[model samples]
Target: MTKRIQHWLAMLVTTFMLTLSVSAVASNETSANSDNERLGESVVRQEITGFAGADYWRMVKDGQEGYTTSKSPEHGVLISVPGQTWYILKEKWMSPLGALAIFGSLAMVALAYVVVGPLKLSKPKTGRKIKRWSRFDRALHWSMAFTFLTLAFSGLTLVYGKHFIKPVVPTEVWGWIIYAAKQYHNYMGPIFGILLVAVLVKWWRKSLFTMVDIKWFMKMGGMVGKHKGTHPSAGFSNGGEKAIFWLLIFFGIAITISGLVLDFPIFDQTRRDMELSNLLHMFSALILICGFIFHIYIGLFGMEAALDGMITGEVDETWAKEHHDLWYNEVKDLPENQPGYDAAQEADKKGSASQNNA
Candidate 1:
């Protein structure tokens, strides 16, 4: 009986102690929560940053959306990196500017048919004239000129081939053609570079922009043909032509250099660097093509008398007298410029005289 009583008492004492211990633990936990509310969370932010790397942190104080990263005891300073968007521009129901440039170019070409009639002249001049270019000079000019034309057409086909022309070309063949076009385009790029250098060397003297050029620029070269007065009187080339020429020179070099970087992989270039080159090359080409389109116009339908300058190296007598008075005067001084002279210069005069007299 004594032993049983002793065992019961010991079990009762052990149960009471365990109950007190558990209650104390619960009370401590509750107190910790209360303390947390008062202490306002020990953010204790730790920041980690490095060169060319993201900023990292623990318990960083940050703002939402545009306003990010604030400073607090718990949160540390935060930095931001910019983000880009991928939205497409819309025009006439939404279109890219590239499509616009293309569409506008086509429209201009079509309009040429309406604006420029058969190569007929208005008022013919029977007077003597000057000689501007020789047969050799013309040969060089036409070679590069035709080369550029071929390259432009092929290049356009390559640039907009898939979007505009793929519907007509068979899929398999189109793929092959595009591949071939790219190959040829790149191959001929160096050729263009060579031609561009030659042209620069050939015309650098005449192409220099002078203070006189400022007057020309302000007057828009006085080339107001569609309106009232006639095109501006010019020497060898006009201000606008000079601008286009210089652009071609700079952009030609740029196109060549960037193209080479991509073609040869000469530098241990990074992918980003390569991507930049591609963008720059395309941008430069786009600008050149835009200028070139106008050049083609002025060379062809836009002007009544300028086309022969490149094709046959001479213009009608009256055409020269009217548009290129200064140049005509210079050539008139040259014995080679005398009419019935039997030279190409004289032959050009005869051809132009026929047209001008019409």
Candidate 2:
């Protein structure tokens, strides 16, 4: 009986100790809450009073002066509101649209090719050839092409590399790639700009739009199946070629000017000026790239015998007559070894010999 009583007493003592421990935990929680409430009160008061203080965020918001060793005006800026806005626009708006402009242009070109196929020649290739682009013209064209392509690819790397390439490449390799792209873009931009200006000046007369060009456009420049027989009046350049030329001229100017503003920061352009320049640069580049897609499509594969004019600086007599009759008529009766001259003489000799036989 004494042992049973001792056991019941031990159980009750154990339950009492557990209850005391729970109460102690609850008490500690309550104390912590009170301390947190006190801390919150102090924090709230500090936050409420902090805005009124001159040093709180005045310097940040107002873009007050700070100390920096860099010579750039933007270096010491604590907080640039315009810069922040520019960043948001660049990241959120321009980048996505730029990507769309490029890829959308490419998609459209692909769709056009699939639907229309190549512009085939109605006549077979004649063995005789006629000069189209002179050697100097070819030299200038290739130089401009190289510079523009270099700038375009490098610029793409700078703009889209982080989002599109970073995930696939290692960080170190990506960094090196971006660095090289930046250097290439910066250096080639000026060369492209200069070459573009020179090319435009040299080819301005040939690219001038005329009533004949308007008619050519209406007839789809004999590229459509129904209009294949119609040789629309064209000079050295056809209507489509003129359009490409003008696109390059206008967009080249815009992109080059804006690129210059961004390239040489020593001009001391304001933050807003830099932002605007950047915006214009991106917009113009997008347009140029879109136009470039069409130019490449047509020059390379969209038309048969067209690439020969640029590559060998010559084209077949039939090809010239079919695509550019006006140009052929103008240069058809020159000296031997010249474009159109040999073909005209051959036709004349064959006709005279047949007349003598008759």
- Every candidate's lDDT: 0.67, 0.86
**Model 1 bad stretches (over 4 Å):** 1-95, 108-122, 127-129, 225-227, 342-358
Error of 1 at 345 (Å): 14
**Per-residue lDDT for 1-358 in model 1, tens only?**
9999999999999999999999999999999988977565433221223322242232232321223365322122232211011111112212246557756876876675576433334477565444567677787777777777677767777656777779997899998988888888878877887888888888899988776567666666555445224445677777787898899889878887887777776456644455556656766776777778877766777666676666666666787766656777777756666666676677798899999999
Per-model TM against the reference = 0.63, 0.76
For 118-203, candidate 2 gives per-residue lDDT tens digits of 88888899767777888888999999989988888888888898888989999999989999999989888999988988998899
Model 1 error, position 48 (Å) = 29
Alpha carbon lDDT of residue 8, candidate 1? 100
In terms of lDDT, the poorest run of 10 residues in model 1 is 81-90
Kindly give the number of clashing pairs for every candidate: 11, 0
Please name the candidate that would achieve the greatest TM-score relative to the true structure: 2
Evaluate model 2: give its TM-score.
0.76
Residue pairs with backbone overlap in model 2: none
- Native-vs-model 2 lDDT? 0.86
